[model samples]
Target: MDFSLLKEAMESNSFEKIADICDQLMLQVSAQGIKFEEDWPYTIHLLGHLYVNDVNSARFLWKTIPSVVKEKQPEVVAVWKIGQQLWMRNYSGVHEAIRGFDWSPQTQGLITAFSELYTNKMFHLLLSAYSTITVGDTALFLGMSEENATNYALQRGWTIDSVSGMLTVKKQPIVTEQKLDPSKLQRLTEYVFHLEH
Candidate 1:
């Protein structure tokens, strides 16, 4: 199977679309009766899924990979470690897995993007979930060093209780406004009237 499409996508840093591209290519590989372990970059394909925050897909991909490939390709195993951490919601382990591996150029971009996405997501979640969190816990959740995480929180307008080593979260107020579409409501009313008859 020619991997030009996959290689081109990676070279262009199209991380958002790589997961879909990998799925398409896998379908072609299956139709052509090509061996998945032959020359395919399973590592990148797996990481692409994670980049899109599709941990379920990434887990399924890990299960489908051949044992030989899993054992021989340490990088593939390392990527799966990140997936496992994500699956278990072990935020600190996710950071450890990411930092422990030396990803190749083909996968580094995707990994970096995933890291940023995960960090931003956790940051928002923590904001809503906590009024105050310890700097150490924040570091684990944000995948940064304690000092860096403290600075990051501070820069985001969060205050720190120096005596307690706790960083206070600055949550933005949520404003929700619901506006119903008249045409849709009219159609629903008509449908109800028709059903009544």
Candidate 2:
């Protein structure tokens, strides 16, 4: 298979750039021709949307994943499941998805990267979900020590109730550029943020 575009897409760290490259290649090869079935690399396309946290695109691609790909590269399915859990805001489910999976050496780096990405996402999620959260819970979710959690929270302008170990969001307007409904805890839904695609 011709993997030049896929390799170039993989070289970039930015998801948007990967998406643009994947989009251009997909458009070029998806026309009604023999090239569509053979030349299109679904893995790069899947990774591009997934890296950007676009679950709608991921869900659409999920059904189209070739069975052989799933069977041969089971880690692909595992990472996608983790992404789905992150999308749904189920931190525990992410752990469950990762537990007991024997990843080959080739896929270990991917798992590590996904773990790092998950921790970053969890911090933002916890901040969005609560005005105050227990340091213990934050540590648990982030897989970090309570000391680190407390320090990180403090660094982010959170007030620490040392006696209760509670990290409270400092009294200030939560300025969010995204039209997020603070009331919704699980899924991101508001204005144009809704998953229409």
Candidate 3:
């Protein structure tokens, strides 16, 4: 199947459409055989799983990634690494993997989306671990400026102790998403190509 469909679906920014397409591609991969050849469809499907914070589904896809694919697209492996770190609540590791991510020039857009998704998820994971953290510390851990961190904390209703610079994590849920334009689909495809051997 042509990636044009996945491209269009991803550009839609609707997780439902992306996931539906991913499921369709997964079925195709099963029928067509996941093999020694390039399987961009399968890879894109895994990306959709990540986009939706579906780590379990993404892990299932990881089991199918050929070793050849692993060697070529370390980003695929990086995806796993990022997920593992998240699972372990190893924000530091997630931070290292995501920040040091040498994204292929072609994937800048798709990577941007993935980066945002992972970053947001990681921040919440950190909150789950710590009930109270210093504002500066939270900012550093979140990779945001102190001011931005304070603003985010305020927005999230996280308690702030101005005198102590402490930001307390309140049990509130929120998602902050700023989607990119759909025009980057081609670049996302080109990026997957770069990951190819």
Candidate 4:
């Protein structure tokens, strides 16, 4: 497999394309009858799927991985721990799995990006889904230390009750960015008028 594209994508931190690039590379390697066990970067391929939040794809990839590889490659097994945690919606487990592994340089960037994305996603979900949440739960969801999570919430304007250690989530107003252009609106209005007539 010519890994130039994959290397370039990683170097540039183009995480969104990693999954597709790895998928194409997997196909090419399979077509050439290349042995995956000897030199394949299975760690990167699996991490790419997780980076893109494609848990189902990650699960499928895990299932297709050869049993020997699964048994022999500790890194691949570690990556699947994150996938399994994600599949089960165990937020704390996901954080623990990510932090517990010392990932190689080749896969570290994707893992970091995945962690940040997961944190941001959980932050937004909390903002929308709950009015109040405990400090420990917030820390687990945000994948940070309790103090750091409390600080993060404070920075985002959420109030923390000191005694209860529960955060009062301050939901940000949703700002719609799609302003109606007058000409387009006029054109749409005219079209509707014609349709009605």
Across 86-105, the per-residue lDDT of candidate 3 in tens digits comes to: 66766556666667767665
Error of 3 at 77 (Å): 2.2
Ranking by TM-score: 4, 1, 3, 2
- Superposed model 4: Cα runs more than 4 Å off: 177-197
lDDT of each residue in 121-149, candidate 4, tens digit only: 99999999999999998998998999999
Ranking by lDDT: 4, 1, 3, 2
Q: Which pairs of residues collide in candidate 3? A: none
After the best TM-score superposition of candidate 4, give how far the Cα of residue 140 lies from its true spot, in angstroms: 1.9
**Regions more than 4 Å wrong, model 2:** 1-5, 35-43, 95-118, 140-147, 171-197
Candidate 1, superposed: residue stretches over 4 Å from native: 175-197
Error in Å for residue 123 of model 1: 0.7
Better of 1 and 4 by TM-score: 4
Compared with the true structure, what per-residue lDDT tens digits does model 1 show for residues 1-197? Answer: 67777778888877878888888989988999977684678888888999888999989989889899988899999999999999999998998999999988767888888888889988998999999999999998998999999998999999999999999999897989999999999999999999999
Task: Please report, in order, the local distance difference test score of every candidate based on alpha carbons.
Answer: 0.89, 0.67, 0.70, 0.91
Q: For model 2, how does the per-residue alpha-carbon lDDT over 88-185 read when each residue is reduced to its tens digit?
A: 87776775666647766634444556567767787887877888899989887876678987887788788988898888966547677977566774
Q: Give the TM-score of each candidate.
A: 0.85, 0.64, 0.65, 0.88
